[model samples]
Target: MEETISIKDIFKTLKKRWKLIMLLTLIAALISGSISYFLLTPVYQSSTQILVNQKQSKNQLDSTQIQSNIDMINTYSVIIKSPAILEKVIDVLELSQSVDQLSQKITITSQENSQVFSLMVQDSNPLRAVEIANAVSGTFQKEIKDIMNVDNVSILAKAELKENPTPVKPNPLMNIAIAVVIGLMAGIGLAFLLEYMDNTIKDEKDIETILDLPLLGAIQKISKVHNKG
Candidate 1:
């Protein structure tokens, strides 16, 4: 037989399972908050900007020279992550990580048609991240002169340690909000599924709907009581 649902039925199901829905939402929010606040490690990011300043013989900037400098930024980005630059930075900083491992935390970014590029590093320690960023940029600035036989790299800004630092990931409020939404959806779906699967007759309405029978009357049971005199 085909089953039809009404708004009233939907409301009835939700009302019946309100406790389950509330419990699931609360649990999800609590777990998400707990993981975000306690379980996950906070990562701090620091960045230093380097400029590709190619000296021109003329006072005004040359278009061809500017384009060449911009194009070379791509090469510089890769070179910054390479062992040629990272090895020196690691050795200078006395970092325990390998070139590949250190490279994973470093990101090189440059804007289109802009000579300035940023060297970003993320670490659990904010001061360490700053130190790594400055070290990598400084090493790249010094080594590029030897590797490419050009002295065009200049440190525009060095990464500085902040008085108070904040992590970029594992936002507890956002995580909890998302978890609450997912939990509500899951709880509602489960509630309807359970309601659909239950076959036991509970009331006169269920009997009438499932059995297709008219109830003349319902039998009432009388309770016996004993009195002592």
Candidate 2:
């Protein structure tokens, strides 16, 4: 016959192994917290904003023309992370790193249906990140006009040193919270699995039901010692 467990059985199993469940949950939370706190590197991000100033013509450009300009800007945004642009930034900052090394720290994104592009730089040093972001923006603005045949890329915002820059990854509290939830799920699953594997009768009712016979007696287990004189 097929076997199944009821909600009562689940509760009883949990009560039996509550201590082990709690310990595993706590251990998982601590391990996740420790890994997030010490094993992950903290990255600080700095971003600079530039607006596309397309010269409005007397004749209104079609939607296609406007979208083409936007598409062109997006293309330039990718090229901003290229070695050409980063090499300039490295030289201007006197950074002693290869172009590939420097490129890894930069990101370029833009707002949708808008003409503004944001250049974000991330590094262990917040100040260096800010400097790199601003420098790249300036360098790109100076050359983007010649490269893209457009004269309207202007800096709208400059990266500044944040008083309390926040790290971008490995959030410890959030990680621990996720770990605790996962641990609880694992504990509940393990509890049910062990309960499913146990076939011995745990109560008098189970014995009576299985054998279809009256339960003569059920004695509570006890431990005692008697001295013989």
The most accurate candidate by TM-score is: 1
lDDT of 2: 0.84
lDDT of each: 0.91, 0.84
Evaluated against the true structure, the overall lDDT of model 1 is 0.91
Alpha-carbon shift of residue 58 in model 2 (angstroms) = 7.4
Root-mean-square deviation of every model: 2.7, 3.6
- In model 1, which runs have C-alpha deviations exceeding 4 angstroms? 1-5, 213-229
Q: Clashes per prediction?
A: 0, 0
lDDT of 2 by residue, 1-229 (tens): 1234566666778999888788879989999999999998888899998887667776676776567667777788777877768888888999998888888888888778877888889898899999999999999888887777777778999999979989887688999999999888887787778777878997898798789999888789898989899
The regions of model 2 sitting more than 4 angstroms off are 1-5, 56-68, 199-201, 206-214, 217-229
Error of 2 at 123 (Å): 1.3
Candidate 1 TM-score to native: 0.89
